[model samples]
Target: MATKLLTFVIFLAGVLPAADAAIDIGKVLGEHREFSLFSSLLSSTGVARATNSREAVTVLAPNNTAVVAALRGVPRGADTRALLSDVLSLHVILEYIDADKLELLAEGRSGDGTRVTTLLQANGKAQGRYAGFVHISVGEEEYDRITFTSGAIGSPWNATFEKAIAQLPPSVSVLQVSGFIFPPGVIPPQPRARQTSMPPAPSPAPGPMAHPPRQPLLPAPAPAPPRPTPATPNLTNTPPPSGNVIPIPIPSVDGGMNATLPSAAGHRVASSWGVAGLLFGLVVCLIWSL
Candidate 1:
């Protein structure tokens, strides 16, 4: 009857989240020098308050050295505070799980993983829903090795379950791990580029009708203007001078006929005409004197 009663007590202890007195995970971890790093960070991130909840919890504790190693790669500064806080939350499991229970859970789950809720309800991509879910599984080569981290956020960043550090019945339990469980938001390092071979593209066929490379068109030279031809008198169509031609006076420029400048030939012709009239007048006077 005592054995049965003890079993029942143990079962109740596993079922409970945390007793009111057992909630201070910080104080418990603070007592141990090895867990001091995790303890301080838990308090800073307020994830330690998760142990004070009415729900049961399991903490996968990484030692101070392990904590330092995990954080070593992370560049230090205030910007990483929220990231560190979320990372700290990843160490915590909301459900009460002893080392033996975690071992049993590892069985039959060869391919698919199991999810464990953490203290960070707001740490994932979604709002209000719990984001930090650690994927639990047993290592293949090492049967005993249990891995805890999420596939939703997979990586070179992973935390391995080492051993159970401490256990408090009906409340909080602490397990030591090899590394820190990285959160979902942090980006991972880029993978190296791989060399690959591909067939080259075929060149365009060069032949008649194929389009040539475009060249800018120079502006066309301005057209040359037509040259002016001088006016020539039509000598073939001109009439010989008659007696009536002498009496016809040259018209004024106002009469609408354009004035033409006489050449040297015209001046010689006028002088010759005046001399012939004078000789004819003298002959007529001598005839009249006889």
Candidate 2:
């Protein structure tokens, strides 16, 4: 009896751990101290809420200082509100992209300058007279040298891609970048020579381990192989040795699912109990008759 009670307790305990497996991006960003500015912008721009609400997505977030600098560079006459909103939109992608996936994409992205439209498309933010496209520069297929160079929407108006800051594994990824990936036509061509097409923007790195860094852009550590456990025997499925085992029905204990006999060991255990019950009942009848 005590052993049966112990088994049920073990099953209930497993439920709590399964709940932890879910990742909450909104809660994660809210608690992180370093994302104050970035998080604020995400809300103000509506990007944060949208991403958190979705199943999965990748975000390239600029730190507070980087965001400030990028905004500061906006020309005097341009609409600051519109530009800032667009800038914030540039940092996020609608699909989930983990570091390992990004690395693989970097190595083999159909880099034919394929343009990836961002969530910003909903905002009516477009580049040139054409639909906007963020082009991630895949330098080469090499392993260690792989990097994010720039994502360009226009001829020379390109946003620099920087290191990843934090991530929640395959579901949500965040990278710190320099400048806005959405280079709306507002940034006019420099001089008439077309001399500087996509000049590299230096990232204002805060520190190595800034803001307890949520998830560095680097690939997630490979998962450890699952450990093997000893196998147990089940009597329910095992062929009953002639009349060796008896079958009985019991309410399913699996949270309303059809009650199922335990595998090998559990089935054998139940059969033994049934056998003991029969022998005891027979002894009682015999004693009563005598």
Candidate 3:
């Protein structure tokens, strides 16, 4: 009877929420050091306060070796702190993402499709790995050298969840399937801008043919009055004046001088030819004289 009662109690405990159930994420993660880097980042970013009371969040985490590997060559300084803030902001989601959702999401995705704005208004991209079968949208900018990053899947939790989280580094940014844990008002991906082909320009209209100007009607010329037949003068010829000498004055040569100048081109050609012939003759004569 005691054993039966114990089994009933165990069943009840298993079914209850952490307030009603036994284990919460903080309690579970308390034991894992692989997640220490993520924890530190959460604290640094003050994200721990947000997650403190939240439940059922499945974190895709990178282990200590993974964290060290990521941070190996990173300078430990103020800059590193700023980088850490962004890295931590990237990893944690407001809610949980379960396994089934992850697989379905992975199968359907390719490339980084969109940036998911979380409840914290943190922005991250969705990336597809595993030949588009697994989606990873991690945005952890490392100030250090990336040495050993956990793969998409890892061992240890090797049995179930480890392969998924371990394969990836312990980052707050991780791949989760759809519908695991939803923060309210998770905005849908933005629509891509539509490419609109411009409409072609309209053709010009045919123009009307131009008409030639009409010829002006001119007034008929007044009929010329019949010219009076030139009167045939009576043939009484006046006798030539006797001994009248009519002298014709010669045209003055100075006033009537009409001289034509040679064309410039013609003069130039004639001058060049003359010079050339003279030169040739001089040469010939010198030869003959010698």
TM-score per model over all chains: 0.51, 0.46, 0.33
Could you give candidate 3's per-residue lDDT for residues 50-168 as a string of tens digits? 55544433354566665564555555567566545543433444444454454443333552222222323323322222111112332234212111111223201110123443212
Model 1 worst lDDT window (10 residues): 242-251
Clashing pairs in 1: 17-55, 17-56, 18-171, 135-149
Per-residue lDDT of 14 in model 3: 96
Candidate 1, superposed: residue stretches over 4 Å from native = 1-22, 73-76, 108-111, 122-131, 151-157, 188-290
The true-structure Cα RMSD of candidate 2 reads 46.8
User: Per-residue lDDT tens digits of candidate 2, residues 1-290?
Assistant: 99999999998898656542444555666665666677876776666665666565667765677566655444443455556566666556666666566665654545443344565654566554434445554544543433432254334434444666667755777766554554545542122333567878899877776466577789989999999997665546666454543344554666453433435555776778789999999999999999
> Which of the two candidates, 1 or 3, achieves a greater TM-score against the reference?
1
Ranking by TM-score: 1, 2, 3
In terms of TM-score, the best-performing candidate is: 1
Residue 106's lDDT in candidate 3: 30
Q: Residue 121 CA error for candidate 1 (Å)?
A: 3.3
List per-prediction Cα lDDT, in the order shown.
Answer: 0.68, 0.58, 0.43
Q: Show model 2 residue runs off by greater than 4 Å.
A: 1-26, 30-32, 73-79, 109-114, 122-132, 139-153, 188-290
Query: Among all windows of ten consecutive residues in candidate 2, which has the lowest summed lDDT?
Result: 186-195
